[model samples]
Target: MQLGGDETRRLADFLAASGSGSVPSDTGGYIVMPTKGSPADVIRALQDLTATDRMDALAMLLREASEKPAILGDLVSRLAADERFIEKAAAAMNLAVYRQVLFRLETMIDDPTVKEGQFQALLEEQPWLFGSEYSCILDRRRWTRDEITDFVPRRTTDGRVELIEIKTPLHGKSLFNWDASHKVWAPGVELSRVVAQAENYLEKLDRNRDGILANDREDVTKMRARIIIGRDRDDDQRDALRRHNGHLHRIEIITFDGLLAIAKRVLRYFEDAPAEQCVVLGT
Candidate 1:
């Protein structure tokens, strides 16, 4: 096989001054090379192009892209051959999309007006913002006769529906109270009310679970729930929330801040992922 490439102006100048045909000890602005190069070498060959060569490369590449669009279908076929391949590809795509999401999330974290309704709307549009624990948002939002949950995202494990009840993050109000006497944390009235509200929603879902399954094919097994309210303002508050949540059995609580942190972790996972695992298509 033969390798082909275009050179960058800087690299071309270096090569000219160096008077070397072979790129010393590394990759080059592609002027083409012998075949049997590593995968990275091949990719660099395609990417490292002079301004003059870029237009021609772009046209040829566009033609190649347009000519064999079935290459993506070929990738899907390859994924079907290996489940691990599919998972890696999916993860790569999700991480690529998360950059846009993180921007909005970071912006909202400090914005006062991005409240419950705003958060709900964002989550509705981008449910993956909730992380991979939840499979997908259920089509059936009305869990019971009078109960309408913010979201009924199904758990990834068994497809059982998990209720997500999000209230406005603590702004001027308090969600936790510091108990000076006992040296412990206590739930503020708002937090207590939000927890109870989530419990009620769970209870209603449990009572109406069979009916819901029959009607909508949605599973609400045992009715576990997540209450997303308040903010972990500082290390103490964050630790306090963690301790408070540890005692609970069925319902789990996370502040908006915690939720954002989860997304950042996900972003970092992709950043650190192996290059081989990151590629879903192309040689």
Candidate 2:
């Protein structure tokens, strides 16, 4: 969701105030005081919080209000009175909606009837799957010549890149085929193909880093690859899948179920964390 000018200013102000020596008081008011650092430093710290952290803070607040009936009214009143809090709350609501959409989209990942075009589109829409620190750098308007490498998402912290490849989540056929004779589920054809493709994409990016940087201005020095395909059928398959992924060095493999697990962990962070800890305000 896009923030308007006013909303952006308010969020900045809130972040600044939070970074200032603002402490939560017993009366539920912030005790704002002088901070040691420069105003610019404080602002930078506020800006350092990733998009995921902001959304998680809001989710935490929502979960807290739900669990504690007594504090619900107080929380709502505070949110209504504080414009910054309301702005954050709105963002949190948007994230929740998006999370639900991602859940629904997972069904199509495994559906054989859904074309690759549709599956790719669905994957493009959900940037959160890459975690909170990464954002999509390529869209339809600026996709690379290579079709195997679906998109490149950059890590916000270090400008490092991840080459992502997508494949349909196949049913019955696991990521690795079960070998009853050998007592192991070996990497299946689809999994091996995608892994090789991702590795190739990584090598290509490393080789053409200068040219890519000239064109897109993204860092590809510290690069890795991710392959999204298939599903874990059962406990045995899941165990074997973990062992298989362990051997891979450059490329990490994940199933649709594994992707959802990552999302769930992120959502759970908000649900479990204390509000104060979730949104830090220096004192």
Candidate 3:
């Protein structure tokens, strides 16, 4: 299908998320075209498109994007996550104008792909990544409101409180080249999955705060929600966090890079913490 500007952006986003997996043959499936240019080049070309313009420019952009295979997956993912794409989708009308775009954009909204056990798996892999000194006590079987309180949260050194929830990122419906070699990752899913999981966990926490919080004045420490993605994310995720500063519930999104950073920091912090502050497995 010939994609309009918005559709083009959506396609780009999907392609970015495909991450070395195979690109789907059908439009309904995820499509990540290869790209060789710098991300800046891709975005610039996208920003300049109009309804009247032929898709020649868009095609060239995609063709060029296929070159830098290493970064293309991540670059396209970031492009799709760009706020401008969201705004454009809100303004779009024609499906041809943005059907592909709308579908990709909608993927971020209520990602149901997050399986029940996935959260628990993420937590098991990286306990300290969420700033949770205690190991996770997840009840993966149910999304019960009552289950929220059974899990214990940790307090940060800065005196903020946070509830750590780990997550896994879902890719577009297709496989990328990396999938052929078994190296799989998707940047858009990397960001959206974390953001979505954090939001869900926060809602639960807020709903059951009375059960979890001892008292209001006790200070809600950091109230954290961490997401552990299988892939890398981009600056757009950081931008999302920056825009939602005050309302962020002290939640933090951690990519593989963030994981490494935390590993180093946690070691130092643990050294200063009192022996009693150490996490006891069941607590």
Best by lDDT: 1
> What's the CA RMSD for each of the models?
13.2, 12.4, 24.7
Residue-by-residue lDDT tens digits, candidate 3, 59-142? 444565576667657646755556343223223222232234233323432365766365554344445534445434343322
Q: Write the per-residue lDDT of candidate 1 for residues 86-156, one digit (tens) a residue.
A: 34544455555567878897788678788788888888887767876776777877768898888888788
lDDT, candidates in the order shown: 0.69, 0.67, 0.45
Give the alpha carbon lDDT tens digit for every residue of 213-236 in model 2: 898776566677888788886897
When 2 and 3 are scored with lDDT, the better candidate is 2
User: Clashing residue pairs, candidate 1?
Assistant: 5-30, 5-32, 6-30
TM agreement with the true structure for every prediction:
0.61, 0.59, 0.32
- Segments of candidate 2 deviating more than 4 angstroms: 1-85, 88-92, 109-112, 135-148, 206-221, 271-283
Candidate 2: 10-residue stretch with minimal lDDT: 274-283
**Which ranges in model 1 have alpha carbons more than 4 Å from their true place?**
1-97, 216-221, 274-283
